[model samples]
Target: MAEVNYKQDMPPKGGYAPIVFQNIPVKKYFNGYTMFAGFAAITSFSFYMYYQNFKRRRLLKIERQDAINALEPILLAERDRSYLKQLRRNVEEEAELMKNVPGWEVGTYYGEPIYKTVPKEKLLDPILEEYYAHTSEKAYDDKANEFLWR
Candidate 1:
């Protein structure tokens, strides 16, 4: 509880410390033009970003509308065709169930085993193997199998 000497730590001649930039005294004053320029820049940037976002959304909406308009008819036609195909399939399935075809038992089994199964030695021929591989991977053949009897 002795008296605290606060005067000794302070500069001998001090009211407030002067701000110096590279040894030059900086005047403490607000530059209205600089503040205004900064505010304008920030506001303008925000507005520009908002405008770009709006423009992008509008363009995407237009593109989506265009795609829907263009593909709507084709999609409708495909839907109708698929429905007809399904109906035909249901009818055929019902008939097959009633008649109970000898070789058409319902099971997880795929198409019949290859009767003319190629020998392992035959697969060693590069030309024959390549041809068989190409035929096995044929897109049209795969798709055709979906609608045709094996």
Candidate 2:
């Protein structure tokens, strides 16, 4: 690598030489107060950046703590909750509601459910249509008969 000399070799200040406006060296031309202000600015910027990072992490930790607190209720509420007991209660209630329905009893069928009669008209039964509406994906089916009561 070639090194370019940027400094001018000069004689020492052994002889009294008249100092003119442009005759001063680079050091003599520097403003100490301005350099000190620049150092202060750099130091302040570094401190500001460090404080911002610390604040961001602190905020994240607080948000995580809030999330944990919010989820505490659901977690603690299940301490004595029995899923099987609730399921049994729901089944008993459902049985009670269907007990008095004329000619309708708690029954299950194998494979796809088959209706006693085919629907002869559009939107004939709301109950059967509602069941299909909730169960079927209701997308990409070109024929409404896929869910028709038949």
Candidate 3:
């Protein structure tokens, strides 16, 4: 067995420093006023952004309304023309269908007026489906079967 020589380590002059058990207090970098100012700045910026978004939405809505207003007259004219054409067609259909009847008028049951009380009789226009109801059995069946499940 070989012999080994070792030097023992020793603590410097005064023994080890005392162990600290209590927590050390740290100084705050920002005071209450500074923190409050930062929060206010962030909040104000967010509100400004929200206001900008609101303005953009309002502008877009106004533009859409203007576009709709500009197109209204043309659309109304087209609708009127379509309605008059349908009315003419309805009158012709009634005349053809009632040709065999003795005294059946186009808008009335007989030669008498359809509306008696009113000074100016306003005839109710039937919808396209109702106007063609008597033309085909299929149309009648479709109307009858409509909402059957309900």
The candidate maximizing lDDT is 3
Worst ten in a row by lDDT for model 1: 123-132
Q: lDDT values of the candidates?
A: 0.62, 0.61, 0.81
Evaluate model 3: give its TM-score: 0.53
Error of 2 at 20 (Å): 33
Looking at model 3, report the run of 10 residues with the lowest lDDT sum.
Answer: 118-127
User: 1-150, model 2: which lDDT tens digit per residue?
Assistant: 998979897888886687677755555654889889999999999999999999999999999999999999997777436433443454466567677666554322232224546543322323433323323356224335556755
lDDT of 3 by residue, 1-150 (tens): 999999889998889999999989998999999999999999999999999999999999999999999999999999889767766777798899899999898777598766777454565767657666545777656766788957
List model 1 lDDT by residue over 1-150, tens digit each. 899867557765657677665776689665999889999999999999999999999999999999999999999999878655654554456456646555543221233533246653342223333223323456445655656765
Q: What would you estimate as the lDDT of candidate 3? A: 0.81
Clash count, candidate 2: 0
**Candidate 3 segments whose C-alpha is farther than 4 A from its true place:** 1-34, 117-150
Task: Judging by lDDT, tell me the better candidate of 1 and 3.
Answer: 3
Clashing pairs in 3: none
Model with the higher TM-score, candidate 2 or 3: 3
Model 2 segments more than 4 A misplaced: 1-36, 39-49, 52-56, 59-89, 101-150
Better of 1 and 2 by TM-score: 1
